[model samples]
Target chain A: MNAFLNQLPIGLSIGAVLLLVALGLTFTFGQMGVVNMAHGEFLMAGAYTAYMLQSWAGRQAVLVALPVAFFVAGLMGLVLERTLIRRFYGRPLDTLLLTWGVSLILQQVARDLFGAPNVQVKAPTWLVGGAEWSGIRMPYARMFILALAVVCVVAIWFYLARTKQGRRMQAVMQNRELAACSGIATSRVDQRTFFIGSGLAGVAGVGLTLIGPVGPALGTYYIVDAFLVVVAGGLGQLRGAVLAAFVLGLLNSYVEYWSDASLAKVVVFAVIIGFLQIRPQGLFVLRSRKLT
Target chain B: MRRLREAADAVASAAVRWRGPVVFVAVALLLLVAAPAALSPFRLELLAKYLCFAIAALGIGLAWGKGGMLTLGQGVFFGLGGYAMAMHLKLAEAGPGQLPDFMVWSGVETLPAVWEPFRQPWFALLMVVVLPGVTAFLLGLLVFGRRVRGAYFAILTQALAAAFVIWLVGQQGLTGGTNGLTNFTSFFGLDLADENDQRVLYSVVAVVLGLLYLAFRQVVASRFGRLLVAVRDGEDRVRFLGYDPALVKTVAFTLSAISAGIAGALFVPVVGIISPALLGVVPSLEFVFAVAVGGRYTLAGAVLGAVLLNYGKTTFSEHYANGWLYLQGTLFIAVMAYAPKGVIGVAGQVRDFVAARRGRAAPAVVPPARVEEGAAA
Candidate 1:
């Protein structure tokens, strides 16, 4: 019972980070229809952003890094969107290969800049402690991240659902020609959507620092998992991303607990494959007239 | 004089018709004869390894190029083939029902029953072809049958590869852990250590690649090939015309898996290692990388792309290890941006341009879209 209770925070924190990453993917991939294989590199860039800020700002780096990472990564995303990704909007496979190239370059650059070894971010003093009950213990950092993830998920959900810019983004996603005809600036919407999505990835990177090791390939680890989140969640649906991320995270936690870490990953993949086989459109599909 | 002129014309047409097969045979002879005579033992082995990759590339051309399925997880099948062969070799090295060394160290007292079947060469050989074929067929049936196409399919395959690598790394005892199966001594009673046997192995690989290439050419020329292209361009139109796009896709995917599997099985003996690192999403992408660079639509382009890029990678990595990744990355981006059609496609464009410039009217070949138009029509 105690172990199970202890597992909850770990699972929730993992779910939170996944949700944050997947939210970004949902926008860039789900909403915008860009494959963006280099999306994971944004996460790596965000983590490195926090790591750099930490050296200059001390423990308060977490506070300073969050917004800074978001903007920095967001700016990069905007540049990439404007120069390259926009050109290949009609070409997903090419976009996939191109973004992967970007990811490789980013990883190699990170390795050169930060060195090949994994970089650990110093946790804030506030998050150093934990809550203990009987033989079980849950760290404050995980709890903090869980809370942050919830806040971010809610914020994104509200933004996408309520904001005018969000509606424009949604309109473009649904029908780019139709949206443009209706007087929506589709290109502007695309730029903003790409920026916001990448910004969220940066934010997720900041959260990642608290939970795991920060390295050049940090994004690589989560990128596929993030893709799975979108795939399982259903394309272009924020609520689905949230629900699916949590399910996958909890499933990952429980499975890892039952077996070795490597097996857990395999099991997760197997489950996703099985799930995809059963529900090819995912758990929550859009009610479009499109044929399956 | 008229009869002699007529006979000369017949011979000219015959030569033109036989050019493709003649070139193919010449390449095969070059690989089998000229290679060993020209290259050292070390270079021969490297060429063999590249040929294995070429085998995988050929399959990618068939599937991704022809059927329009971007199979990013071929490394899974390749690994499956490698591991199957590696298991047999490990058992052969161990000599009759003995637990492999790693298994013993990991406290596995007995050889796992699952691995026992691979002890036979016939069984292992069958598995190299059958395993990946079955896996691909099932996966294709599910995904393609359900109408999963384009990037969605690519992402799914990539995820499977990532998962597969993780799984292989985790099951260290069964899979020889991260070190993979090494120190292979014999292959089907032939001493692998002998230099002559090594040449034979290279010859066998060359012959297999040649046969695979020939087989792929026949498939590409057949009626099924046009159907595949039709489906790739517009799946819905084909479906409405009463053809099953899913079945066509599944067959192409399965053919690709078999090729990848065969490459993998050959790779173990030639390369002597089959680690999970070699079978990840990156490596799988490398398979696609060869196809993309070669001209995915052309079988010959696939073979050339695999050989040239792999040789480039080998030499580049050997001299300046770190620079290789940068080059590879740059190439990936450049290829996608500038050369979406790849080398062969570029050549076709050039030919068309030259013909037009020379004032010879040529049929305009419609430029293929970066993405398939799909069932939208």
Candidate 2:
């Protein structure tokens, strides 16, 4: 019972990480319909940003790295959008292969810039310890990641719901033609959406450094999981992403606890496949009148 | 009787009208007779390995190129076929009741129940095709029936590959873990260590590839092929026309899986190992990469792409190991961005350009042959 109780926080933290990584994908893949396989590389870029910031700020780099990584990753995404992904707008599968190529190039670039070995970032002094309550231990790093996920989620919510630009973005997601007819610049909206989506991945990468290894190949490990979250959550539905992330995270944590890590992965995938069978459109579906 | 005679005459005329058979015969001769005679044993083995990949690529050409299902996790099927072949070979090498070396090393007390049936070579051979076929059929039905496709299907398939590798790696006792099933001495009584035997194996693989290419060519030229393309271009329209798009897609997916399985089975003997590393997400994606580079739409293009890209990979890695990934990435981007139809499409375009230059009245632009048929349909 105690072990099961302990897994709740662990599950939540894992869900938090998944949410952070998948949040950006919900925008590009879910809303914009561009399978930017290179999104994971943007996350890698974010982690590297944290690694770089450590030199300037020492142990305090993680805090400073968050905003910086966001823009750095966001700008990289914007450049990719303008240069190559722009051409393959309507063709999602082609975009997938194209971005995968971009991802390969970016991974090699990362490998070249940083030696192939993983680089370690010293955790902030505050995040090194853990807090215990009623015999359940919670690491500060996990809590920090969880907090960061919430902040990112709330901030994204604010951006999309409260802000005028966010509303414009939502409008485009709903119906690009109607959005364009309303004098909203759909192209510009696409750029902003891609920027914000890729930026969130950067932020997710920053949060990840506290828990995981930072390396060139780090993105490939999480890319599929992040994609699964978006896929299960239903495209362009924020609530669905959040719900799916936590559900998958809890399922992963519990399954891993019962079985081995590898078996847990297989079980999670099997479950996802089974879940997809029942709900092919995912947990939620966007209502649109446009015929394909 | 008159109508039947006319139909036969038209079929004969059509066969003669197109230069397809001449090209087919030329390629057949080159692969079966000329190339085997010219290349050394080592080079021939490498060619055989590439041919295994070509077999898988042929399936991808039909499914992804022609039918529009981006099957990114072909490695799973490939691995299934490979492991089946490898298991039988290991059992045969062990000689009657003895465990394979890896099983002994891993301290497995007895042959696992699953490995029991593999002792029979025929059962293993049957499984090589059946396992992946059934898996694809069920998966295709489940996913396609629900209308999940495009990037969703691609991502799902990729995740499946990742999971498969993880599963393979974890089962150290059953699967040989990360090292995978290897060190085979014989295949169906043929001594693998003998150079002549290896050459014979290569010939078998080459012949199988040739036969598969011709068979798949016929499939792509059939009525169902047109429906597959129609479903790819517009699934709802096909559904509205009273055809079940899901069923059509499932058939193509199953066929692709079976081919990939056969390729994998052939790959084990040709390459001499079947490991999790070879059938992971990266390798599966590489299979698709070969298809994209050659021209996904054409059988010849897929075969050429698999052979040529693999040849390029072997050569490039030998010269500059670090540059290969960058080159591969650039190639994928360049192909998708500019030459969507691949090398075959580019060749068609060049032919049209030259022909237009010679005849000023002719239009400069002509659609690639297969794509033109698809569009016209």
Candidate 3:
């Protein structure tokens, strides 16, 4: 019981990061049918932003760095969409190649700017300690990340479900032509969608700093795992993404404990393949006709 | 006199048609065959590895360019073939009943059961082809059959490759861990270290590459290639015409997997190493880059693309390993933005322009815009 309780926090914390990354990918995949290979790079940029900022201002300002990283990465995402991605809207394969090129460029740029070695982002004093609950010790940082994830999920859900702008965003996602005809500025929506999606990735990167080292290839590491979350959950479904993230996170954590990390990945991939064979549309495929 | 004039015209047209590509291939083959003698063994080995990569690029061109399946996880197939061959060689080196050195170093007590079949070169080669094909067959059935087109397919495949890499790295006992399979001693009982043997292996790779190129040309020129291109243009239309788009895609993807597997099989002997790095997301992207830069839609383009990009990589890394990433990134971006049809596409454009300027009566060559419009429509 103690081991299980201790493990849940770590799983949940990792799930938080996965959720953030997948949530943004859901938008890009769902709306435009584009596989942004550079999605992870967006997350890395955000994480690196925080890392750099933390180095300059010390650990106390980590929370402040999160939003700043979000904006920086988000802005870049908007620019990327306007310049390169917009041209490849209906051509998904070309988009995949183009984004892959962008991803390489981003990674190389990161490598050039900040040497090849792993860089650290120090944890704040308040979040550095541990919490003893149910005879199991849980790290405060992990728990905090979990809370942040939950908050972001709820905030995104509320925004998408309730707000006028959010509804317009959904309208575009559901039916781009219909939404545009109804006076929803689709171009603007695309910009905002990329901004939010990339911002979420940035937030995830900030969240990742708690557990792992940040480097040029940090995003590449999470690229597959996050893509898995998006696919398993059903492309574009935010709620589905969170659920899938939790499942994968828990499965991966348990697999790591029972076997090796690499084996766990193989098992997860096998399971995903099996699951996909069974449910071609995924765990919670969107019901809209447009995607079909 | 009229028959003589007609014969001369026919001969001239045939020569004009075959001149450029024929010369290019002849020159390339001559250079590669001569390279091993002129260059050091290290450079010879590097060229051999580049040929292996070319094998993967050919597969990508078929699967992606012709079939429109944006396969982001080809590394999974590549690794499967690579590791299968690697396991066999390792087992062979370990003798009749011993664990491989990597397993011994990692404290594995016995040989893995899955690896038992690879002891025979025949079995290993078969698995090298079959394993990736079967895996791709299953994956294609699941994704393509369900109509999971575009980005969804790309992401799923990419994720699978990533997962495969992680799995290989984790299985220290079965695989060679993160360092990957290395320290091969022989190929089918011939001493690998001998200069003669090394030269033989290089020649074998060159021959295999030539044969594979010919095979790909035949396949792409056949009715199957037309079907693939049709599917790429309009999956729904093809379906409406009573052709199963999924089955066609699966076949192309499977054949691609077989080619990649063969490449990987040869790579184990020539490259002297096969690791997670070689089969990871990055390498998979590199294969795609090669295809894209060489002209993904053309058969010759795939081979040229892989060879050129890999050669560039070898040169760049040898001189500036630290800065090569930047250089590669610049090259890909420039290629994608300025030359979407790739180098072959650009050459074709130039050829058309020159023909137009000369005011020569020439056969109709389809414009890229028409191809793009047809695809989009």
Candidate 4:
């Protein structure tokens, strides 16, 4: 029980990070139908952006680093979308290749600027330690991330359900032709979608710094996981993505307890393959006439 | 009168086609054939490794370029075949009834059940081809059977490649655990290190690649090729025409898997190594990059893409290992964003432009040779 308790923080922390990344991917896929393989690279960019800010402003302002990372990475994402991704809107494969190239470029840039070795981020003093709850000790950093993720997910859900722009985005996702016909600017939706997705990736990058060392290949590792989460959930379905992330999170955490991490990945993949075989449209695929 | 005109047009096109592409292939062949003599033994070996990569890229071209199945997981098939061949080579070196050095080092008293079949070279070779084909066959039957196309298929394949790498890395006792099957020697009693023997190995691989290319050319020119394109372009329409999209895709995917497996089998002997580094998700994506940059829909393009990009990687990394990835990434972006049809497609456009300026009728762009006959434009 104690051993299990000790491991929960790491698992949940990673899960929170995964959720943020997947949510970004979910938004993009939902709105633009682009896989954005470079989504993880965006996270890496954000992490680096945060690190750079910390160096300039010092570690005392790590909280301020959060919004700064979001702005920098989001701007990069906007540039990527307007310049490269927008041209290949309906062409999923081309977008995948192009973004992958972007990812490689971003990683190499980091390697050049930060060197090939891991760059460490000093955690804020307030969120450095852990507190015991129900005989289980969870780190404050992790709790901060978990709380942030919950708040983000809920906030996005409310915005999507209630706000005018959010509804327009949802409308565009549901039926682009119909949305356009009804005076919704699908192009604006695309821009907003890119911003939200990239912003979420930046947030996730900040969350990641709480636990792991920020490195060049950090995006390579998480991008695949995000893809798995998006696919295993339904493409473009936020709720589905959240659910899938949690399920995968719990499954991986428990599996890591008994097996080597590598083996756990294999088992998870096998399970996903099997699950996909059973539910090819994914666990929470939305029912729409346009799905075909 | 129409028949005479058609015959003249065909003859004229064929003659024009032979001028540029034939010259290119001839020059490429001369370069490849003369490379061992001109270059040092080490460079000769590195070039051999690139050819092995070309073999894998050929499959990607056929599957992605022609068949329209974005098989991002060719690495899994490549790794399966590589590990199989590596196992046999390892067993042969270990001699009768002895476990491979890594297994013994890892404290396995006896050979694992999975590694047992590899002791027989014939069985190992067969499995190298069969295993990947069967896996792809089953997977395609399931995924395509459910009509999972586009990004869904791509993600699934990538996940499988990642899973394969993880599995190989984790199985320390069985697989040598991430260090992968290395330090191999003595292929079927020949000295692998001998300069002459290495040359012979390269030539043999060259011949095999040539024959495989011809075989692929023949396969793509058949009726089946048309069906694959039909399915890729419009699956519903293909179904309306009485062709089963699932079956067509499965066959193409299986053939591609076998091709990748054969490449892996050759890679082990020619490259003298098979590690997770070569068959991981990164390598898989890199292979896809080669195909895309080379022009996935063209046969010569696939082969050329694989060879050129790999050479570029070696040269770039040798010079700038730390920052060269940016160049590679930039190349990918440029190729896709600027030339979706790839190098061959660009060449075709240039040819058309020259012909147009010369006040002659521009030759029709030759469809990629890897597509089945009816699918050819």
Candidate 5:
């Protein structure tokens, strides 16, 4: 019973990390319909950003790294969009292959720059401790990640719901032709979407440093899971991503607890494949009138 | 003189008709006779390994290029076939009623039930083709039945590959763990250590690849091939026209999986190992890379691409290990960006350009606009 209670926070924290990594994918893959395989690299870029900042900022580098990493990753995404991805627009599978190439390049670059070993970032002093309540031990780092996820979600909600540019992005996602007809500059919206999407991955990376190992292959480990989250959550639906991420996270946590880690991975994949069998469109379906 | 001219015209038209088969026979002769005679024992074995990859590439060509299913997890099928063959080899090496060496090391008291059936060489060989075929058919039925495709299908397949590798790694007692099944002494009754036996093995692989290539070429030229293209270009339209797109896709996917399995099975003997490392997401993507580089739409191109790209990989890695990933990544991006149809497509363009320059009408070549237009719509 105590073990189960302990697992709740751990599960939520895992879900938080999943949500963070998947948030950017929601924009690029879901909204823009571009399968950016290099989005994981953006997370890597962010983690590396935090690692780099440690020279001057010490343990507190993570807090300052968030906004910086977002921009850095965002800019990298913009360059990828303008240079290579733009040419392959409307072709999701090609983009998948193209971005995979970009991912390979980025991974090699990371390996070359950082060497083949994992570089550890010192957790902020505040994030080192944990709060214990009724046999549930919730580390401050996990709590911080959860808090960050919530804050990012709220900010994103506000941006999409309240801001005009956010609505423009939504309009483009819903119907590109219709949005273009209304002078939305669908290309600009796509750029913005890619930036935010990639930026969110960077933020996710920042949070990940507190919980997981930071290395060149770090992105590859989470890329599939993040993708699965977006896949099960459905495209162009924020609420769906949230629901799916948490569910998958809890499933992952509990399953890993019950069985071994490797088996847990297989089980999660099986569940997703089985789930996808029933709901091909996923947990949420976007209602569109466009015909192909 | 008029009769002689008429006869010459008749011969020219016949040559055009027989071009494909003639070329196939020529390539077969080159692979079977010329390759083994020219290359060293080590190089011949490497060529055999590449041919295994080529067989898998042929399937990718059919499914991805023709049927429009980007199967990113072909390694799963490949691994399935390889492991089946590896199991049988291990069993044979263990001799009658003995557990494989790894099983003993991992404290497995008896041969596991799954390993039991594999002891029979025929069953193992049969499973090399059957397992992947069945797995693909079921997966295709489930995914395609619900109309889940495109990027979703690719991602799902990749995830399956990842899961498969993880499962393989975890089963230490049964699967030989991460080291995988290696150190085979014999195949069938032939000694693996002997050079003559190795050459014989190479001959068998080359022959199999040639036959499979010819078979798949026939498949791609038939009415079903046209239907597959139609389905790829427009699935909804094909469905409205009273053909089940799902069934057609499933068949193509199944065939591809079977070929990948066969490739994997052959890969074990040629390469002497079947590890989780070779059956992961990256390796599966590498299979796709070969297809993309060669020109996915052409059967011959796929084979050529597999051999050439793998050759490039071997040579490049041998000289500069650190730079190979960069080169590979660049090759993918460059091919996708400037040469969407790959090397064959580029060659076609060059031929057309030369014909046009020589003041002759360029041959009627189908534009590779189906994928772009379909996606755009």
Candidate 6:
């Protein structure tokens, strides 16, 4: 029971990280239909942003890093949306290829700017240690991330359900033509949604720094799994991303406990493939009338 | 009889189409000689390596360009074929059932059951074609049968490739693990290190690629080819016309996988290595990249894309080791945005421009390929 408790935190922490990353992805990729392969690189950019701020501000950087990473990565996302992604709005494959190209460039640029090797950031003093009880210990970093993820998910849910802007975004997502007819500024909403989505990814990247070293390839590593989260969660559904992330993350952690990391990955993939076979529409799906 | 006359006319039209083949064969023969005479041995080998990629690209042209499956997991097939060939070579070198060195090192005293069959050259050669083919058949049956396609299919395949790499890396006892199988000395009684043999291998691959190119050209021009394109453009319409879109896609995908597998088998001997790194998501993406760069709409474009981009990579990496990726990345973005159809499409545009300036009748400019909507994963 004690060892299970020890293992549970690790699984939950990984799940938390995935949930944060997937939260960003679920909006831009899932709702808006933007196939941003560079989404992961945006995460990497956030990590690097956190890294840069850490050097400048020292131990106190963690507190400021989340919002800073959000704005920095969000601004980059906004710039990308306006300059490149806007042109390929309806063209998903082209967006995928173009964004992938952007991802490649971003990765190379990160390597050029920060050097190729992994760089470590010091955890804030507040998040340095762990909570322990009867030989079972959970790291403060993991605990903080879990709480942060829950808060973010709840905040996003509230924004979607209660806020005027969020409703407009949902309106645009559901029926763009109808939304445009009803005087909703669809493009502006797209821009803002992309900004917030990318900002969330940046936040996730900062969250990542609490546990491990930051590198250029960090985003690339998580992007696919995040995509899996989005896909398995069903398109344009936040709860699905949360549910999928937690399931995959927990499964991966438990598998990793039994075998090496590589085998664990294989098992996770196998499980996903099997799951997808059974439920092609994914775990959750929203329905709408189709006059076509 | 009317049927006999129609058959005769069919043969006649096919003969007329032979004009394209004449030019193709001429190009092949020219390349066949020019490769050995113009380039040094090392460069010739590198060209051979590129030709292997071109073979895979040809498959992409058939599957993606014409059939429109957007397969992003050709590397799995390629890896299967390469590993099959590499295992054969490794086992052959291990001599009459002594077991591979790595397996021994990993504490296996005898050859595993799966590795035992690979000891035979013929079985390995057969497997190079069969392994990827069967795998693709099974995968296509499962995925396409369920109507899974487009970006979802692309992502599924990408994940599969990643999973394949991880599986290979984890199974140290079976595979060579992450380090992979290397240190090959010979293949089929010929010394791999010999310059003459290297040229021989290069010529052999070049000829095979040329043959495959011709084969695919005909396949694309045939009536079945039209059906494949129809399936791509409209599945429901094709179903109304009494063709199963899923089966058509499966055939195309399976063919693509087999071609990638053949390329992999060739790659093992020319490159002298097979590893999980070459079979990962990145390499699979690069396969698609080569297709995109070459102009996925045309056969020659696919081959050209593979050769040129790969050559550029080797040259760029060699010359500017530190930051060549930046240039490559920029080039990819520029090409994707400005010339999404790649060099052939660009040339087509320029030709139209010249004709327009001269006030002559411009040939119809081909529009860029369309990406299907709602397939966004």
TM-score of chain B, candidates 1 onward in order: 0.93, 0.91, 0.91, 0.89, 0.94, 0.91
Q: Which prediction has the highest lDDT against the true structure?
A: 5
lDDT tens per residue, model 2, B187-286: 8767888988988898899889989998998888899999998887778789999999999999999999999999999998888899999988889999
B1-377 per-residue lDDT for model 6 (tens digits): 99999999999999888967687777787679877899999899899999999999999988988887778789999999999999999999989958878888889777778999998889999999999999999888887776766677777788788888988998898998998888888888768999998888888899889888888888888888888888877766787888888898898898899999999999999999999999888899898888888898888999999999999899988988866667766777777787877876788778778999999999876555555643643
Share of native interface contacts recovered by each model: 0.65, 0.64, 0.58, 0.63, 0.62, 0.42
Candidates sorted by DockQ, descending order? 5, 1, 6, 2, 4, 3
lDDT of 2 by residue, A9-42 (tens): 8899999999999999988988888888999999
lDDT of 5 by residue, B150-230 (tens): 888888899899889999999999898899999988989878889999999999999899889989988998999999999
> Candidate 2 clashing pairs?
none
Model 6 chain A weakest 10-residue run by lDDT: A283-292
The runs of at least 3 residues in candidate 5 whose Cα sits more than 4 Å from the true structure, single-residue gaps closed, are B1-12, B352-365, B369-377
lDDT of 4 by residue, A1-292 (tens): 7778767776776677678878888788655678798899888887887788786667754577778888877888888888888887667777888898998888888888898899878888888789987777888988888897898899889888899999998888877789999998888789888988898888788878777899999998888889898888877777888888877887788788888787778778778778877887678876665424
- Residue-pair clashes per candidate: 0, 0, 1, 3, 0, 0
User: In candidate 5, what are the lDDT values of residues A1-292, reduced to their tens digit?
Assistant: 8778778888899899999999998889888888889988999999999999999999999999999999999999999999999998777888999999999999999999999899998999989989999778999999999999999999998888899999998888887888999999889998999999999999999999998789999899888888889889987789989999999999889988888877988999889878987777789987665442
True contacts kept of 4: 0.63
Docking class of 3: acceptable
With a 3 Å backbone cut-off (N, CA, C), the pairs that clash in candidate 4 are B220-B372, B221-B373, B225-B372
Calculate DockQ per candidate and list them: 0.56, 0.50, 0.46, 0.50, 0.58, 0.51
Off by over 4 Å in 4: A1-12, A56-60, B1-33, B352-377
